[model samples]
Target: MFAIERLNKIKELLLAQKRVDVYELSEKFSVTEVTIRRDLDKLEQKGFLVKTYGGAVLNDKLNSLPNASSGDTEQKFVEEKRMIGKIAAQMIEDGEAVFLSAGSTCLEIARNIKGKKITVLTNDLAIGLELKDAPGVKTIVIGGDLIPLSTMLVGGFALQMLKGIYVNKAFLGVKGAQLDSGYTVSHYEEAMILQEVARISSEIIIVADYSKFNVKGFARLGDLTMAKKVITNTQLPNEYKKYYFEQAVKLFTTFDFR
Candidate 1:
């Protein structure tokens, strides 16, 4: 992997997990301890962390801010997400309403949406704000309890808002994905809401990076069967690629689009 990509992932891990060990990062990226230290040093110089005895801790200044958490999520796989977002945005036709689920990748989709006259329903505060000023886009945020650590809105209030309407397409993001587990997230309440949305939508499109592949989370919403298409990075393994194909799922890679 490129240095910038690895750096972004390390930053992401530190922000999410609070700390990062030199050895663990080395092993995770298949690099040497010396290389990991250099990476940490670079982060340190940029005020992202404080180097400890054997690892680095996320900056104290960043820990208490919700914005920091969301920013870090966007740091990883940025190019891939941007490409996926661009391609996903292109898939939407004029006057077709769509649902934009909450996540870093889904936020990218919101960012890349073009000048189409369409209504947008989303449970993400970030997505709502992103499209607030866009021309020819009408955005609606679902009513729900806000998750403390991020901007996601979920639960019964969100579900009730979707009762009478169906969207042409729903773009979703997943915390983990496996053939067995399908698409999952850490929160059960959010899972319930997303599952309902998936059921009501005519077509489901998942936007995720390779890091989510084979990972399992606490709660699942929809499976590969429910997802009509998946937009992801080229870093995904051929094994998973073949697996999606066997399931009759259309997989669009960022590298292919570029």
Candidate 2:
């Protein structure tokens, strides 16, 4: 294929996948890695993509990709998150303090709870705002540097605040969950605060949809073993059931819970 045709194909892939690595592109196009890098450079210069360490991501100006914790992300896995959220909220006992991590799934958990007198500590600005009218639920925000994309407060300030309190459970979210890296998120600062939240909580429960499986992120929060339980949709593949059992992590699926 011609150079122009290959470059156009790469752009199409980026639009669909949001990100792509040089190695994969090279193999897919039957070209050298150096050739792929040159194509990426051209794309970046044209303001179509932003080149990362070994990959390229869609440029914000060119693609209106939704924020990670925004409504769009919420809608992507609506039914799955709703099921996981309800099951996760059920894990909380009445009047128990809990840490609700920032994400679409975590927000669903917050929305599903009713008539529960609980103290909710969260770094998500949206979660804190939603709990204001939750009747019987007291919401506290962990103040720090706010990340606009995810609406999460990270950095040292948030970490210190979380350390001062212990909760019954922490319902955490992640960009991906892989057998090797466990739970992972996109940003390093976010991962740091999430790690601390998991540390202080007695039970670390990961609430994710089936889509998150096998996807790896830029930063890993902790190993899968850190989770006491995992709440997911009924669609969780059967192949992963044995892994969760071996890790001694309890799995709650909508199939059984819902």
Candidate 3:
């Protein structure tokens, strides 16, 4: 395999097992021990792992560990999330009716919708609060059982609120995006509500950071074709870029820090 592909495989192994033996990796990749050691040394310098006596361990201190909860997940991808939100927000035209799903990135989208006359239907309590002070924007909060840490509402009550209302666009945030099983969120209830949102919207725009790619969550939302566009940062892998492009799904990337 090529060096970049080998490096990615090593990362995937470290993510799944938390540690990797040099001998095992060398055998698995069919390369010499010297070459595997060199790869580990480079990954160590990039803060992806730590070299040990005979192997390497995933760098927990560098965010290589899995997140414990949605709250932790939201806080970990701050920069990419904010940029994704900014790009998604710019797609909105004045007076459009939009559905903003519940997540940190969706909250950022709500925060960035400045000086626009729009109607926002959202289950996220935090997003409602953020839009309360913005002029010419009508914020509708879908009511149900509140998921406190995520500041969102879900379940039958929220589903009832969405009935019969069609939207111009739906901006959704998901826990993961997969090539086969498709977009998913951590909670089944949230996934159900998101499905309803997708049903009523004429257009779907998924707002997610690059970290979410190739990951699968507990509940499947929809297939990849459900979304017309995806807003994310430039860190998306070339493989995914080619896949999305081939699928005719438009991708918008924001690489800017500001």
Per-candidate TM vs. native?
A: 0.75, 0.73, 0.70
Tens-place lDDT per residue, model 3, 1-258, is 899989887876565335677776775677999999999999999988889877887787744345622243344456667888888888999989999998778988998995899999999888999999998898899999986334779999999999989999999998778788898886789999999999999999999888778777768899877897999878888887998999999999886645
lDDT of 2 by residue, 130-191 (tens): 88898899899999998643478999888888766899889899877888878888678989
Tens-place lDDT digits, model 1, residues 5-114: 99988988776557777866775688899999999999999988999988888888987776685463455556677788898999999899899998777888888784
Native-vs-model 1 lDDT? Answer: 0.84
Off by over 4 Å in 1: 1-11, 14-76
Model 1 compared with the native: what TM-score?
0.75
Give the worst 10-residue stretch by lDDT in candidate 3.
Answer: 68-77
Instruction: Please report, in order, the local distance difference test score of every candidate based on alpha carbons.
Output: 0.84, 0.81, 0.83
Q: Mark the regions of model 3 whose C-alpha exceeds 4 Å error after superposition.
A: 1-76, 256-258
Top of the candidates by TM-score? 1
* CA deviation > 4 Å runs, candidate 2: 1-76, 256-258
State each model's C-alpha RMSD to the native: 7.0, 6.2, 9.8
